[model samples]
Target: MNARVEALIEQARGMTSEERVAALDALQELVAPPDQAWGEAWARESEERLDAYLRGDIEGEDFDVVMERMRQEFLVK
Candidate 1:
């Protein structure tokens, strides 16, 4: 392993069990792949958007209206 990783591992080894668990959790998040992190962020954003839509904080066409518009655009092409 790289020197930094080796050093980090040694530091983790010196921690207490509870600290190790927290450290492991933090490390896992730190090393998580970008796409996995992005997926989580996107999920959170989607939930927030849905909540806002439900609360009428966001205004937009409904799904059927969107679909109909898409169909008309496709037919024109």
Candidate 2:
């Protein structure tokens, strides 16, 4: 590794766990920033889904039932 990265790693070692996690998150954002357009699309989709649910145009499933079904499909041998 380069000297700058080695220095940064050494500094990170001195940080608290939460501080290290914050630093890691900052580094990841620098490496690959989020897509603003995709985020906006998801926000619009979520709002539309919520409106449908509120209008009773779509029914919601129970959380526990969904989890049990997922476990049976994915975890059962």
Candidate 3:
């Protein structure tokens, strides 16, 4: 790594957990900002799903039931 990044990492090591998280978030935004188009697409998708649910064209499962089923399918003993 470059000296500047190494120096930043060393500085980050001295921060509290929360401070480090905030710094990391700031750096991530600088590296790659949030995608507004993706957010708008998801918003539209969510509205469509809700409309379908209201129209009785789709059904929703209980959160706990879905979690239990997912655990059974994916978790290894």
Model 1 lDDT tens row, 1-77: 99998998999889999999988787777897358788999999999999999999998788999999889889766
The alpha-carbon RMSD values of the candidates against the true structure, listed in the order shown, are 13.8, 4.1, 3.9
lDDT of 3 by residue, 1-77 (tens): 99999999999999999999999999999999989999999999999999999999999999999999999999996
User: Candidate 1: lDDT over CA atoms?
Assistant: 0.89
User: How many clashing residue pairs are found in candidate 2?
Assistant: 0
Runs of candidate 2 with Cα error greater than 4 angstroms are 1-28
Q: Candidate 3: deviation at residue 5, Å?
A: 10
Of 1 and 2, the candidate ranking higher by TM-score: 2
**Local distance difference test scores for all models:** 0.89, 0.97, 0.97
- Give the TM-score ranking, best first: 2, 3, 1
Scored by lDDT, model 2 comes in at 0.97
Which residue pairs of candidate 1 clash? none
Q: In model 3, which regions exceed 4 Å deviation?
A: 1-31
Q: In model 1, which range of ten residues has the least summed lDDT?
A: 27-36
C-alpha RMSD in Å of predicted model 1 compared with the true structure: 13.8
The ten-residue window of minimal lDDT in model 2 covers 68-77
Tell me the deviation in Å of residue 58 in model 2. Answer: 0.3
